[model samples]
Target: PVRPLWAAAATAPPAGAEWVWKATNDVLNDLYAVLRFEVQRGPLSRSPSAVSHANQVYPKLMPFLRWWKQQPDRPPLYYATLDVKGAFDSIPHQKLLEVIRPLLREEDGYLKCPYSRWCGKTGKARTVYGVVTKERFGDVEAVRERGRRLGHGRGSFAVFMDLVEYRLLSRTQLLALLTRHICSHV
Candidate 1:
């Protein structure tokens, strides 16, 4: 089970806020370790076979195939793509909290996220606390700085290029590309 960072810090209460910060670091490290393990285990397979068969084909055909097998007449093949502008940014904090609250284990004043693997042992899991005052795009500088600090390969320039490409293509253009190529064709 996950322990609240505040609780760990409070064990040596005289150490004050710094203890809390240390506990947070410990929790985050634990989470990162789990992520790293999963990535290394090949479970996050990004190969062409995995991506094409598992991600694209399965999601696209599963529901349609199920429905078609149950029906008497052959249904026409049709598809539609949806575009939600600023999908993550549009979510209200209270609503987001409502969705997340059920997954939390509450004790005293602090909350522990029991559902997240950050609760793992091995002294790797660490947690950080912060408030979201605005959308992620509104705090681009902080995001860039954190990414740079972490030495994550994808930098601000790469992110900007992706955003530019996304803006250049409409939903129709994306759908056209999807329909024009099969897994082998691509």
Candidate 2:
């Protein structure tokens, strides 16, 4: 049997949140964990689309560099790196739950059926979220078009884009993203 949820406990005040909530993944439970592994025995791995890590770098970065170098009009290149700080935690609890609720045991196949003959009435979780839509909520060109419609000149948008590009390049990187041909093995 696997526990659906357990209140792990709250955190101390001032330093962290007054009561930080933690969700648990019960993937280690013996019965279903074994079944899950057996079902996936030696198959090709599938990655979660929304989750990414260091392993994705080599395949993308190396190919991109090769393509960029081969380009006839490629500009002076400066490698820039940016990582969203605490990105997952920055997601609203309601938004995260919104993504999860529809995929619960009854709705999604990966989640095991609760019981074979268990046809019972249960309330699906609900949370109210206030959403606001703004104009120009996308790419630089779209934003520039919005500004133009509101009568800001082309120069304004160009300057805005330049500032954005400047800030990205000037931000401190975790590792200096300089190109070097040091092929030493780890």
Candidate 3:
């Protein structure tokens, strides 16, 4: 059983008619604890926060630097890192839940999603919000690198890099650079 904790518009109509669903410890302490545990069992082995590519790439850098050293006149290089502040929030909740649905099929638990019980400031409001369950670490997802299990995933960062590199740098230009820097050195 959940309750609606709402606040009316501070300034004008629809300015901030916010509705917050409150899941008191009394209502969900035991059930959600179990819910969280059941969903997490034997799944999502990939760690989202690990810097795995650094391991593969750092070792290869030795070869690249050695190759670069052999070159007559090397141009300046540019490689920047992107740190998205709300990278976790950018992903849609429903989209991620859809991915997790299949994993839950084998789960033997039967718990109905709790919804808001009270009406909002609006007359007889009935905007029912669901339980809103998620992983203990809400942001962690399979899209992240399987750092614990290196070979498990191709890595989200790697896939994103591939897409960006494909669009920004032409194959011929990359191949020519690699060839001039690597093959000739070999």
- TM-scores of all candidate predictions against the true structure: 0.19, 0.21, 0.20
Off by over 4 Å in 3: 1-52, 85-186
What is residue 113's positional error in candidate 1, in angstroms? 14
- Between candidates 2 and 3, which one is better according to lDDT? 3
Decreasing lDDT order of the candidates? 3, 1, 2
Could you give candidate 3's per-residue lDDT for residues 1-186 as a string of tens digits? 322323343455455555544432223233333334334453432423222245755664566667777899999854532211111244444443343344333232332222222323333423221212233123323312221222223321121111121112222332334334322222
Q: What is the C-alpha lDDT of each candidate?
A: 0.32, 0.30, 0.33
Prediction RMSDs, each to the true structure: 22.1, 23.6, 22.5
| Cα shift from native, residue 184, model 3 (Å) | 51
Reference-based lDDT, residue 15, model 3:
52
lDDT of 2 by residue, 1-186 (tens): 333344556546577335545434222232222223222332312422211346766775677678778999989976532222221234554453343332222211221111111112331221111111122223556444433333332322212222332111111120111101011100
- Higher-TM-score candidate of 1 and 3: 3
> Alpha-carbon error at 161 in model 2, in Å?
57
User: Quick one: how many clashes does candidate 2 have?
Assistant: 0
